[model samples]
Target: MRKLLYLTGLFILYSMQSMAQANDYVQIQAGSYQLGDTASLANPKRTVYIESFWISKFELTNAEFEKFVQATSYKTLAERYHNAMVFEPGLAEFRWLQDSTAYWRFPNGVSRGGIEAKMDHPVTCISYKDVLAYCRWADCRLPSFDEWEVAARAGSEGYYFEGFSKENMSEYANVWHGRDHLKADYSDGYLYTSPVGKFKPSPWGLFDIFGNVFEFCTGKLHGDGDRYVAHARGGSWWCSKNSCSAFNTVYIGSVRPNASFSNLGFRVVKKAFTPGDKDF
Candidate 1:
């Protein structure tokens, strides 16, 4: 019994070490790829150059963010400000309201279960500033607009990635089923955020690049003065074709740095590094 337990402990430790070494990221090689579609801010489908960078395979999850909070005693903007945007269900149309108690742990407030039930789901209700703080603690940074779109598109050029069909959109992403409905369609078996990697991933093995939650990227908003907005890309579960169609890989949702929403989250990236790097 002792030997078995000891072996299990060693295996767990080894797995953790391996993940750390890999940074749990997918490397997009330096190259040119088509960027944007007609319905997007970055339109024209122009070819753009992207230097190689490492992006996390999955969105940041509650479990991972909890570790940073526990270690650094961090308080997210939602917690500090006592309010965050939440999608109130069972309405004539989508109702996004600011709820005071909706923090990362209780995404929809106390009505929904705690973070324990959502450890694997992407962490939401986090602001751009909160994301930056987490990245700093993790020794990583946010991916730029081009880098994120590159990884999201992989090698495909159309709105959705290759192998996408409207007949079975659920197989590809967690997007809304159809036209605007009071609540999210549960026909896809999830009314809210699905677990990361629950659906298909991009060709680069990056998961949940389409739907789940909008992943924020640094970008400029037109006519917005000097304040830049975080470009919320890839849409979210709340996105519907007739509504917020940013899920199509072209349109981008933008938010301020201090804004927090229930359907907005982010991933991290790091400069290309080898296993022999001192930091690694």
Candidate 2:
């Protein structure tokens, strides 16, 4: 039987445990969008057609992920590996470092309050597989590359997503800038991750789509598909104009599904199925 469901006041289907505390889901209309840009080698320009789907307005929050953890007692890849990953911007290059205690609880591996303090913050230190586990528990799945970009663009067009240029990016998304790449700038008021929806949302009503954390999508880079089955969308707070600008709309990155990182996280997507399909 097909039944109607209400999520965040939007008529949706499949009201499940995942939608309990995180009821905010945005419905993106089916349409075509231009993908990629001239700035990066990883992204090639093309037009993509997308089907209508539902996605969270904001990145998945710690409180939401916590609910999944409490119910399933699931151990994330970081937990299984007994280590968590962090992005480090060195003098000339950037890298990811692992710390035994730097799981989702303590993104830096030393913070005391952890998620308890910032329940509304987007959850980090999670792997693509860990995301799959949450999707299974919630009866949802990660957005595909096309779906993610289509939704991330959210009907915006330009050199950048919604707000372009380096000066005003802080107003649109949580990114690292306002100074040089080699210098630390907290003018945005966040050293690490900020609470979701802290900045302006996209025109079509998606928050933190450009930056916050690189969201995992089920798309693979054809060049590196042998090792990576998933690609990351949006730049993270670690991104700057001169450094790691994958935050740029056209930028698509590959990450191992089994590897989790401190600056990496994911969001959920619900398919708009045929009229008679089982509800969620």
Candidate 3:
């Protein structure tokens, strides 16, 4: 009788644990996204399988990033290095030239006083290495390319789940909402960033995965600027219709690991697989 009771208790514990894993995760229906189309841009579609895992429902907010900085006193690459390509107002002042003083805190570095913005907007001007370091501190990591895509697409087939037309960009992303670089008013009355979760959540409950900022991903590259580094994905706020499209598939590297840009940032993903795990 004692042995039977013990066995039953163990069985119940095992069942509960199994059920938790299944219910805690959302299964991303695996598929392929064609690259280099009006929808896919100049990227080639590749086969990728991403396992189930939990991701942030929204981009890392400035308030949250501040917590990381406060705890670790971690200096972002942008701070350690200058001329980091910031977006400042006034075309004549910053016309076709990168600002050497630009960093995460001072995106364009035009403000003489300091940042007075709110803290809920997605943190930008962060490098891949900085993201990786933050993730490590939090016991989290960046999502893979396929994982990021699956979350971004949110089970949609349209050029953008919101729509493919440029006219629809403002409703979905922060791209060219108010500012127009061609005109002086381009810098007038624009919120460089908005609070995270301000936009509607994707079908999978992820927020701002497509536009607020480009996210870093985990992948080894063998060509282009990625020959010696991993690549990042998603477009950024600085993107333009003719020059930079935030919805397109793009990638960069973490080889230097110290490189930082205002347009770059990242999201976190929990590891679902471990060594010798044949469950993939």
Candidate 4:
């Protein structure tokens, strides 16, 4: 009876610790900013107002996701579908291929011998539904498109938060440095995805806001007969300046809510607590 009580106490303590750690967030003050790129006709720039909220400082990591999985026994979309899109380094133009056994646990797919996921790396191969499940479990929600763009810009007005120069990009993000799609320049010391926060943070101290992986947002497409398609921001390691300059603050990508890609992931946000509210 004593042993059972002791184990129950330990479990409660661990649960409390996990809850505290998962709720960590950085405060973003209320502000108005441009939502889209001024250069692109498809998605022209527009003014938007965002309320003050708490956003995660870094992308959701494999270690953090593991806790949720363990707690809820939640299986990601990649696992449920029994396949995931993976990057094929040998291909020149179109490099993404679907592998039957790929999941978040094995990001590179089963053919590559199922490499273990890095704990610090951002969790990938997750669908919008999967992100929703995670947010629900974590007591948070995915950031909206306007909020995401505002945070990525970090009060800067440029193509990138830092600038458009190659040197600035190399210092701030992880993107393809060479012209060839198959070969990365490795100037950033990462060929595929680097661990979250591997590069310098934005002015708001947000990491991996521009690159590392395409982060899903809460926005959906409407008007033009397209609805329920989810929004994604930032670029990935596979993106190049010439081909897909998705690293810019104004770029917004869309995907089906059920579609899960290797380069796609998400962060979370919550309303800022008041002085009298209970701590999250």
Candidate 5:
């Protein structure tokens, strides 16, 4: 009888802890907003409506990914394949290179140290499949393109909310700002990924929505391909005004779902349950 009571008490404690974690999700109200960018021929700007959902205030970090990996003993696509794309500073115009040892733990490759102090840095080198696995483990899902843009907009319109200027770019985001791609000014005090929430939050209290790392979204078919490719948004430290210019929320970037890149990462979202909700 004593053992049964102790077990019941432990179960209750675990349930409460899970509930508290779930409560950390931010509630985003349902609404209609314009999606896509006019500049891109692939994704013309269009108005769309989205249902209410809950999303994490910040991007998934190395620490969060570590927990998922430890709990599930899951091997990311990069780990299974034994290679992932990384940004090589030596390459001037284009910096991306495939390094056999690059993965989430060692984003720069095996030559670099593990993410000990960079636990707060956004987890990169994650493919779409890997993101899906993490979302499943967390009981969440990747937000659709429309849903992601809506949340990123934070109840505002235009390329950025307001007050976002070249002089103040470092205050809001992390992007390339040197004379060339090979050199990072580090005016933002970070050469690569910045710690999540290091910059000011959006109007809705979301962090690193514009820069730090490109966030993966749902898959979609583009061009003549029968297979759907995954999408990412917000750009990263590699983006610059003359180069990627990914800070513009209108931009919709796409890549193969199976490919993992150093500038890529993801966050999760959950359906918002309303009063009298009978199903999920």
Candidate 6:
């Protein structure tokens, strides 16, 4: 019994070490950073500064998130409530309920078609509050709006690390264009979340910043007020190409963190620098 216990302890320590090492973050130059193009004050290419810190290279996977829930027995907001809002067009054949059990574990649970694949994908249907708990439990915190944008852009102005175009999105992201959802076979493309790190990493070594899931951050959606909400960065698999502003930009203007839905999830961040030890 002693030998078995020792082995288990050793294995647990090794796993924690490995997970820590895997958290690779980039160091953006300490200075002002741009937000977005013209015509949108919400993201008017404003400049912001941030202290350096280590952030996860990818969003939390189902496997990692599962571990958190296992240890904490934390019931997600959706799971607590019997249902959540689902956004699907009205079909001539059937009626879709406004609220359904759309928790992260069972996305599209009430849909007509089945969802047996992509269980390992990042868990969506998560609200900002759920993500906040995960971050705190992991001994980390969500990145601020500016920090997320800087890390995502990785000092590049292109659509992604490889640059954007109709030709390259298939390899870099899961946007609505280029055969993801417009297919009839249901087996062609964009049916579900691709495995983490399945695509190339950005210049700073981050993955899936353009699609897959909209990551929840620690920042408030808009100016501080009694009625404020947490914000999410990046776009999700269900977002359209023409409306890719959610992906192209970063900031949490006006949203409530506890809003339960399927289009939200989060990543983690670790401390890598001292706030007062500025050299730039």
Worst 10 contiguous positions by lDDT, candidate 6? 179-188
Q: Which stretch of 10 consecutive residues in model 2 shows the poorest summed lDDT? A: 1-10
Per-residue accuracy of model 2 over 52-118 as CA lDDT, tens digit each:
8888888988988998899889999888896677754443446666777788988767643466778
* Cα lDDT of model 3 by residue, 175-236, tens digit: 54434554432321344666666665556766666667777788654454535464666666
What candidate 3 gets wrong by more than 4 Å, as runs, is: 1-42, 89-101, 110-113, 162-165, 177-180, 184-189, 249-256, 272-280
Candidate 6: where are CA atoms >4 Å away? 1-32, 87-99, 110-119, 158-162, 178-188, 221-225, 243-245, 250-254, 273-280
Q: Comparing candidate 3 with candidate 4, which one achieves the higher lDDT?
A: 4
Better of 5 and 6 by TM-score: 5
Which regions in candidate 4 have their CA more than 4 angstroms from the true location? Answer: 1-24, 113-117, 222-226, 273-280
lDDT per residue, candidate 1, 1-280, as tens digits?
9999998887777666656756678988998888887655545567898888889889999988998999899999999997798875665665677888899998877676667877999999999999989888888888887788888877888777777656666787787775666655886787778889888877778888888999988766454568666777888888766777677657667688888988888888888554333332
RMSD of each: 5.1, 5.1, 6.3, 5.3, 4.2, 6.7
Clash counts for the predictions, in order: 0, 1, 3, 0, 0, 7
Residue 180 lDDT, candidate 5, scale 0-100: 72
Q: In terms of TM-score, how similar is model 1 to the real structure?
A: 0.87
Per-residue lDDT tens digits for candidate 4, residues 1-280, read 9999998887777676655644466778887876676676545778877889888888888888888999899998889887678886666665578887888878768676342547888888888899999888877888987788788878876666755455578778888887777654676787777898888888778888888999998765543265678778899887877768788777778778887788888888877543233232
Model 5, 1-280: lDDT tens digits are 9999998887777666656655656778877887666776766778888888888788899998999999899998998996688885657675578888989998878786668899999999889889998887876798887788888877766677566665677788888887576654677798889999899877777788888999998856366278667889888888877788888667878888888888898878877533332211
Q: TM-score of each candidate?
A: 0.87, 0.83, 0.72, 0.85, 0.87, 0.76
* TM-score-better candidate, 1 vs 6: 1
Q: How close is candidate 6 to the true structure, as a TM-score?
A: 0.76
Lowest-scoring 10 consecutive residues by lDDT in candidate 5?
Answer: 271-280
The global C-alpha lDDT for each of the candidates, from Candidate 1 onward, is 0.80, 0.76, 0.60, 0.78, 0.80, 0.63
Collision count of model 1: 0
